[model samples]
Target: MVYFNERDLCYNSIYPHNNSWTMSRIELDACAECDLLLTPARPAVGDKARCPRCGYLLQRPRKQSVARTFALSLTGLILILPANLLPLVGIKVLGNTRDGTLWSGVLTLYREDMWAIAILVFLSSILVPLINIVLSVLVSGHLYFRRPNRYLPYWMRWLQHLEEWAMLEVYMLGIIVACVKLASMADLRFGFGLYAFIALLIVNALLASCLDPYLFWRRIEQLQHNHRHEN
Candidate 1:
């Protein structure tokens, strides 16, 4: 039997042992928000777990999470090059036509001696997004194929931390703001790159939705444990 202590914020499990009962604390799960120790009850498919004290979402398992994430991440990778290299928008001001690509934007900032802003934009917009997609593919692909990699834990850690730095949505918002500002002054034309960029953003969002960090961590642990036993 398992019971929770509301005052101490701990879950204790009791087991029968030779005409007696042994009580032990279960530390398998911890609430990410309130730091409450818990032995989480497994929720059924499409169900979720929440922290009792803080009301923070603890876990929500998705069906075929690994396969879904891998597919979306791979699609994002394929879309990224065109999203960055091709012209995103074209503008005509008094017969002077100008096309803007993501790479060109960063280079323009650098050429204007705004090196710091250029670097920041480059990292947040282009580099970080690419890294996140690649890492997602690597992690999900390995798991989907049942491959036990020693570096899986490290990859997952970096993926989670770097998620905050990938500002694709922010960049998209900036693009929208620029378009709105430029509409009155110039004739704006959307390009193929804009469509690809939008698709990439959608795919990234889907990938994030399909990934279950807790499930991935548990699977990784099981994989490594099984590998150790086999060896």
Candidate 2:
């Protein structure tokens, strides 16, 4: 069952469904854009509902979306180890070969006194992905355990905001471009870490792209409600 206090949404006291004898919770929600009262239809998997007034997408119930996201997040998290620990690229310059990990790039930048770029690279390329993986695990694991963090709503919202700043995919593209430019001058070989980094990039992209705020709130509500009753 879904429950929301209208006051939280700046309700106008307009009761479109004023009729009595309601068995369900009315499936009511407000559009974030226009505050239109929307009673979402029970959509099947892969189906979407749109608000009639403003054409905003109300809901698209993707089955196992949370599970899929969790799996990808876990995979990306595992890849982070190899992505940083193993060598990412092997450059053969004049028949002398050397490989470097992601951290090595950051260290190189730091050694050159390019602190700003080095920090940016470390945060966006490494720290951001780590945060996303942790957030996904924490939130998704809470839901799985039917437990509530009490501040999970705020935590989840904060995570969403942080997600906007992640640049792992762009970082990967930069790596690809760099390799392409150096291909003629040196025989470039990808290391195991590079392969892991690529996989992490793909899953991280999917995790960020397919996430739905509405669905997240809904799941949080369910977990919180269940936890309260269990007390």
Candidate 3:
């Protein structure tokens, strides 16, 4: 039997269904309610509900998510420097050794008449990571400092939207495939850059997940509130 006390938000009163009870609670705001669990249909004012977890509000981000995301993004940016500079993969076949950095990989593709693949590799491995990291850092820093950066939010939204295209892990997969195939023919020695690139992928994943657009907006709201109070 399903029943709820009057104090329970899920509970009901006047016309209780045969299988359930009713309760009443003040609905403060959608941002503070169980929005994620609510039916696709938007919640009406005065509606009683609670989030599946914590039962507080589904929209509110964990307080530290912003800081953590910023930190991870910064760390990823720092790693990117070494990942590109150091030799990512090395091949020593029959005592003949060859090493390549991220750019060299792109150049190799180009020299092999793999123009399309070269461009893709360049974009995914180099351009995309640079753009995503720089934008993430800028957006997070703006929010952290409580700066009035209208464009920062726009950039953050775009970064979040474009995350799937970054494909850092995909690049890593390509590297692994190349390494495996080359190792079969020659001795392969992974370099510091290869490990750094791998670490970068994990760090980038965490950075993206930790960033929450809603949380940044909340910061903006707080800044606005303070400005009004001052005025």
TM-score of each: 0.89, 0.80, 0.70
Better of 1 and 3 by TM-score: 1
Better of 1 and 3 by lDDT: 1
Q: Which stretches of candidate 3 lie over 4 Å from their true place?
A: 1-60, 221-231
When sorted by lDDT, best at the front, the candidate numbers are 1, 2, 3
- Compare the candidates by TM-score and give the number of the best one: 1
Better of 2 and 3 by TM-score: 2
Q: By TM-score, rank the candidates, best first.
A: 1, 2, 3
Q: lDDT (CA) for every model shown?
A: 0.85, 0.76, 0.70
**Clash-forming residue pairs, model 1:** none
lDDT of 3 by residue, 118-220 (tens): 9988888798888889888887776777676547557867786777778889878878888778877988888999889988989987775566555566575
Displacement of residue 196 (Cα, Å) in model 1 is: 0.4
Provide the lDDT at 16 for model 2: 44
- Deviation (Å) of 131 in candidate 2: 0.5
lDDT of 2 by residue, 1-231 (tens): 122223434333544445675423345667777887655566666776666667677666666877776777777778889988999888999879989888988999999999999999888878877887888877776766667889778768768878866787787888889999999899998899888888888888777655666787788988787888889
